[model samples]
Target chain A: MARVNNWQLGREMSYWYPEERPNKQFAAVFDINKCIACQTCTLACKTTWTSGKGQEYMLWNNVETKPYGFYPLSWDLKLLEMLDGQEWSEDGGRYEGRTIFESAPAGERVLGWRPEDEDYSYPNVGEDDCAGQVDGGASIQMPHMAWFYYLARICNHCTYPACLSACPRGSIYKRPEDGIVLVDQGRCRGYQECVRGCPYKKVFYNAMTGTSEKCIGCFPKIEQGLQPQCFVNCIGKIRLAGWISKPGEERPDNPIDYLVRIKKIALPLFPQFGLEPNVYYIPPIHVPTSFTRQMFGPGVDAAIEAYKAAGAEGDDDLTGLLGLFGSTEEVLARWKRSGDTITGYNDKGEEAVSVPLREPVSIRPSYDKLYQITRVNCP
Target chain B: MKKTIPKIVLLAFAILVAYASCGGRTVSLSEVVVVPDQQITLDPTDGAWYAHPYHPAKLILQDMVEPRLLEPSTVEVEVTAMTDGKQIAFRLEWVDDSQNDLPGPQAFIDGCAIQLPTEESVSIPAPQMGEEHKAVDIAFWRADWQAIVDGRADEITSIYPNATVDHYPFDAESLKKDPDAKRRMEQRYAPARRLGNNRSGPRKVPVEDLRAEGPGTLSPAKTVSTGKGVRTEKGWSVVISRPVPGFLSKEKSSNIAFAIWQGANRETGARKMRTGWIPLVIRGAENE
Candidate 1:
């Protein structure tokens, strides 16, 4: 096991892959509170990619209701149960038990668990089910009818992706340019190590082709300096895309850095897994604190506080950056809002997207009232 | 009593010699003068295979250690091969205590496959389902598809009594539309298994003719081939036959391989048990 610093974990943890950071890591911060599960992002991703045979049930981008929903049906619960009783020391900031690699059974590189085909037959079997009413010591409790929130998910593209580490033939690779993880279709032998090793179950088995496939992070779009389809077509405008610089080399002007590093309002998902997932999320404030803390880490409280503070105080820079989410398809390295327009700059400080703070509004008389005047007298 | 003891001893000696001659897990492709009248069917007792010289190909089954999935509990497969002038056939059988023939929810049926090089141009493709530039053609046989071929009902409601449907859009007569409605209805209930035996048709067939250049490159071929599997009490028996026009050429030897998948073990994709390439040499008419 190799020990490496993971800012998301707030401590060094074990990983199988070496520490080779990317120049400009592609990252996103999703505001969970803003997501309405309109599924516009899901359709956008489906139409762009994953619309082939054997991929009928695949959702490269998905939004499931939290507290009772999972795409692969209990993917997280299974991993948690396998690693049950594993302890984490807050003071020491280290995990005591085995990670996906350390706990691998004899003769295995990573713990292998395969969900049955039926597990994937229905991608939205329990999209919005409610959590069981366990009133005892459970910290996060909600009223009988109104407890669930939408959780949009994609491949984390982790700093230490278990999928990449588990591939025996080295078919799965993480790019050095922007740290996008992809499966080399030509080299994969359909050995689903990446599928079995992924804790989130984002990597999928294409039975028709007899190989594994995963979220490509829209690298073609990313390479051209444009945001992913999911980010662009978000009906709720909940996603912000930019580069996440390495720790100790903080680029404060970077939109992703400002939210994840400077303000620390967006937290990486399941940091305890210790993969340093690049996607960060602003936890849903309405959900129970204990549940949010367990899902996001101990930083949940602080993250929620910082987010609320930004919105309440009208911090224009932070608010302006937030408004830039889904502002335009072009990827923004840095952005700020001035007056009625939000201007986005690329990595080289070249102007990319200049969208209005709000679209132009028009007021016209009602049809009945408009009949009283013609085009010449409409004004 | 004395005469009976001699007879038993002689029988035992003959059996031992046959086992030694065949080697532990290796079989030879024997050329046959007559292809059985009952050909192109998955029958283990077909007379053509019995009349041909047979070798016991032993199989050492193991877990897919690469991705490190579940270890295979069963350890052996019995293999035999025979070829007429027109088609080549292989029959594989193994001992499986459980008969997992239904591909139900969370259930995987038994399956096996045969792989051969598409072209004899380059070195034999990597056994790991062939790599790019070194293409290998594979014919996969699954129990679920076989059951449909055998005219067995494969509806989930029939397979699992407890599986019930409260209501479906197609069930409502008011919502029915002609021409494509029945197919759309079948798609709703039996999304993966509706085509039945016709499922093997290349363009619309469920069982596809696939070729792989390397690990991740398994792709469907433009045309489909013939293969079938059957579930037996002990395990599964399968036959995969194809016409290789120049298989018996005097000059060159051939490489062929097989893979087995136990769906009950959650074996699919890269999680399978396979054998390395086995040389197949055919005797020419001159030798005969």
Candidate 2:
């Protein structure tokens, strides 16, 4: 074991491999407050990469309602039970608990479990299921009748991937150029240790191929300077694909670094697990702290407060960056706010997306001069 | 006698490891005799196997030293080998409560393998997958592979009987209706087969020839071996047939090893029950 720094944990933790970060890391952010759970991203990913045999059940990207939903039944609840007393030293500071690697069984690399075939049968078992209770005829207010939020998920492409460490054959690899984790089809003997080791249950076994496979992070598109299919086709505009930097190496102009580091409006999901997950989520503002804190770590209440200030409290930089989500097909590398408009640039310093802090509304004239047609319903 | 294997999975390495002497454990010679029986057949259920006496080879944890082992489901295997001077065949039997023939992500396959030194020498390499430059040739027999070769498991439907499927676009209806659809589907979906991952490929023979230099260096050899497995009332009885090892080809007396993995216990590579080099002496004509 090697002692490596996990910025999310605010301390060094035990990891199988020595700390060797890539030059650039693939990352994304999901706005839970904006997601409507249409599953367009899921189907887009399915048709693009996983339409082949043995891939019928794989959804590289999925949206599940939090507190009662999981792709493979209780993927989180089981590990949470195993970890037991998970707590943080402060509200948004150091995590004072065991990570999956620290709490792993003796001789095991990670704290994980393999799901049965039946567990993956229901991809959306608890779709839109409510959690908290409410009395009859509850008023429509901030604390809603029942709390539920859409959580979009994908491979975190962790800095210290559990799947990579569990393979006895060393078949799984994390690409140093893009930090994308992949399975070497040739070297893998189909032991399925990667399947049993990933805490998020993202890696899947292809029974037909008899090898494990996982999200490629769409490196092909990334290399071509375009966003992933799911990120580009998200109809809800609740997702953004970009590069993330370390805590001290925070780039204020990078959209991901700006939201995750500068403004701290977006926090990693289950940071206590300590994989240094790249994908960040903006917790829903209305959810109870008791539930959200454990899911997103001690940063939940603070992140939600900062997220609220993005729009209602007039934080222009944050309000501008949130508007850049799903704004273009190009992967955003650098972003900046100019007065009322937010402009995002690609890696090559070319302008990609420019959006206003608030959308503009226009009403047509009651009568047209050229066509001579009168509007039926005029305000 | 009611056989009850102690649930304590603490495998004492000094007793069973080939290099235990290097670790300050005194070595005691354990031998299993291999006689020259002309009527040896590669049929595990041959009733002829009852004629020869079974040699008990107690198993130890493979690769990992003690305190590192979680549990080993298989404790021992009964071995009996016969040779016609040209080829060698050995029958391995063990007791298992569950017969695991399908190797899915959640399920593993029951298997047994016999390993032999590639060269003839008095000193043998480390028994835990051998050391670098000291290659050990191995022949492995898997229940799942045997099931496929026996026409028991044919395709995806065979592994997962109740798996509901709408359709796979690559698996065109025209192709499924073809006479050799199984071969074609095996070619398409099973990428391992296409890339020549002999471990996961469609099995023409029940056993594959493999060579290993170290723990993670197991690869397919250039030769072919044959085997058969039959799930009995107690467990599995498997017969593996292959050319005599170079060490055994030159000398009548040589050393060999045995390893078995219990799928139900989630055992596989580097996590198996194995034995150290057990001395084998072929019986002479005078003795026969």
Q: Specify the highest-DockQ model's number.
A: 2
| Per-residue lDDT value at B139 in model 2 | 92
For model 1, the superposed segments whose C-alpha errors exceed 4 Å read: A1-5, A10-16, A50-53, A91-93, A117-147, A185-192, A206-211, A313-316, A336-342, A353-379, B1-45, B83-89, B95-109, B113-234, B240-259, B273-288
For candidate 1, the TM-score is 0.70
Q: Report the Cα lDDT for candidate 2.
A: 0.81
Off by over 4 Å in 2: A363-379, B1-29, B37-40, B63-69, B120-122, B173-190, B250-252, B285-288
Judging by lDDT against the true structure, name the best candidate: 2
Candidates' chain A TM-scores: 0.87, 0.94
Cα lDDT tens digits, model 1, A189-222, are 4556677788888888654444577889999899
What TM value does chain B of candidate 1 have?
A: 0.73
Consecutive 10-residue window with the lowest summed lDDT within model 1 chain B: B197-206
Write the residue-wise lDDT of candidate 2 on A236-268 in tens digits: 899898999865898899999988988787888
CAPRI-style docking class of model 2 based on DockQ: acceptable
How does residue A75 of candidate 2 score in lDDT? 88
